[model samples]
Target: MTLKELLGIFERQGIKRIDPMGQKFDHNLHQAVAQIETPDAAAGTVVQVLQAGYTIHDRLLRPAMVGVAAGVMQQVNTSA
Candidate 1:
């Protein structure tokens, strides 16, 4: 699911969604997980949580999807 969809889940659950990356949530996710150690990662699963202590206690909509060292998985080509 898309990041927006995840946020929707939180909204439905009466929870507040926090976007660390601000308006650029996707870009923020990429920046947050970059250069982090994620051993035994899957093909499209590299968004490893570095630390959770910093997170405020609240209902999470869902974890963000992050690309590996390369980049995110784009379903459609943006070069049009």
Candidate 2:
């Protein structure tokens, strides 16, 4: 699905979309959908959201809403 379609999910879910390039969720969403690796259920949800036609941005400048596996640690040091 195109990025425009992905942002629609956020609008439906009432979640705000942020433009964080290289972000995990963004990256995962793109990778999963692009590679057809995302779970069936999740992919279905994405399709549903897109079909709903609810987009985050008003006109342009919107990103994708990704559903990635949780618990993955960020690169930031947490052992301080």
Candidate 3:
């Protein structure tokens, strides 16, 4: 059987994949691996998924390893 077939079988068994791309960062569902500063997306949004996560029924089997978008930091002059 192919990988797709295996995945289909798992889905039928109530194992589902968590898609985190473009979604808001949720500690319950995602594990932030890095904070990426980008203007393309809002801060706290999931910018990249390093590893796909799964869930069995309503229980989370693993959190999706992801990179969260961070707002560009503005340099504040401390010396006056």
In model 1, residue pairs whose N, Cα or C atoms come closer than 3 Å (at least 3 residues apart or on different chains), thus clashing, are none
Alpha carbon lDDT of each predicted model: 0.42, 0.38, 0.96
Candidate 2 has its poorest 10 consecutive residues by lDDT at 46-55
TM-score of each: 0.24, 0.22, 0.89
Tell me the deviation in Å of residue 45 in model 3.
0.2
1-80: candidate 1 lDDT, tens digit per residue: 99789767756766564433212324333334553333444333444434321122453435444334333345787796
Candidate No. with top TM-score: 3
Q: Which of 2 and 3 is the better model by TM-score? A: 3
For model 1, what is the alpha-carbon lDDT of residue 72?
33
lDDT of 2 at 23: 37
lDDT score of residue 35 within candidate 3? 97
Candidate 3 residue lDDT tens string, 1-80: 99899899999999999999999999999999999999899999999999999999979999999999999888899997
Arranged by lDDT with the best first, the candidates are: 3, 1, 2
Q: In candidate 2, residue 68 scores what lDDT? A: 39
**What lDDT score is found at residue 26 in candidate 2?**
38
Give the runs in model 2 whose Cα sits over 4 Å from its true position.
Answer: 19-80
Error of 3 at 19 (Å): 0.9
